[model samples]
Target: MLYDEFNSYKNFVGADVFKNKATEKTDILKNLNPAFPVREYQKEALGRFYYYVEEYHQKQKPIHLMFNMATGSGKTLIMVANLLYFYQKGYRNFIFLLALATLSKIEGGGQI
Candidate 1:
């Protein structure tokens, strides 16, 4: 009975609804230009990230991203830009955990 109820609910929503939502969200994101103009290299990096994310989804695997970059290399800028991009694409909740030094620098308005 519970399984039948769940199936009925699924039927009402349709199996492809989530995929459609993801596609629509991605389309909207692609149309948006981030506040910070992305450099050529950054654009290439972002393209690769997007490609890997899509590939993971296609394989039905969970996506895990790690941005490994050197200090003084605009890592924070890239992170902020990506956050804004995702926020525009319907993401709302974000928890930014930073080290003590980094947090102090951000609080001091030294870095973003």
Candidate 2:
């Protein structure tokens, strides 16, 4: 899942089901916000997340993914990237940004 590299989802789903739609969406986002600045790790992470989504769809099982970063480590950006990627896969009403009691307290409060 390199930035300039493209991933093919030809295994789990059909040969051309998504057709690199995730890459297309990411490219579109990069073009639209050339200055928005998505880090390399973010791209790889979101790409892996998208891969898991494909796995979930093919297996009909729940898959859990997590992103751990220090405070203000651009995790919010990762979260948003995740949401947008899956949204393109036709998933609506995503639940995001939940944490356990201690972690929630560390954040002071979670909103949005």
Candidate 3:
């Protein structure tokens, strides 16, 4: 499965891959609204994503990744972090796919 492969790669790189790198980009997280605090898992997700992107960049490989998380697990926060990271990396455009339920939850002020 995809997660298994990711885990294998992560293992080869050691536990350092899980370190929270998002907080290091204070310029990005500093701009977030005070009402929304990013959780530890979200930071770890961003860290893993950054590690994956860097490794792929070094190999000149196409960058593509999927974040598998449970409902209401704060995936949107991770996406926002990624957008900020990419923008910092000089990217301008982005697109995100969300389920209708997720949209309603966000619109309804439910936890995302």
* Candidate number achieving the greatest lDDT relative to the actual structure: 3
lDDT of each candidate versus the true structure: 0.52, 0.54, 0.71
Sorted on lDDT, best first, the list reads 3, 2, 1
Off by over 4 Å in 2: 1-28, 31-35, 55-60, 98-112
On the 0 to 100 scale, the lDDT of residue 70 in model 3 is 90
True-vs-predicted CA distance for residue 29, candidate 2, Å: 3.2
- Among the numbered candidates, top TM-score falls to 3
Residue 77 Cα positional deviation in candidate 3, in Å, after optimal superposition: 1.0
Error of 2 at 67 (Å): 0.7
Model 1 lDDT per residue over 4-97, tens place: 4434644787754333433444543454344344454454345445444554244334545666667755556556656766776788998776
Q: Give all TM-scores, in the order shown.
A: 0.50, 0.50, 0.71
Q: lDDT score of model 1?
A: 0.52
Query: For every model in order, what is the number of clashing pairs?
Result: 0, 0, 0
lDDT of 3 by residue, 1-112 (tens): 5456657877887755666455677888876655678888777787777766765444334666778899878887778778888898999988867675655756446433
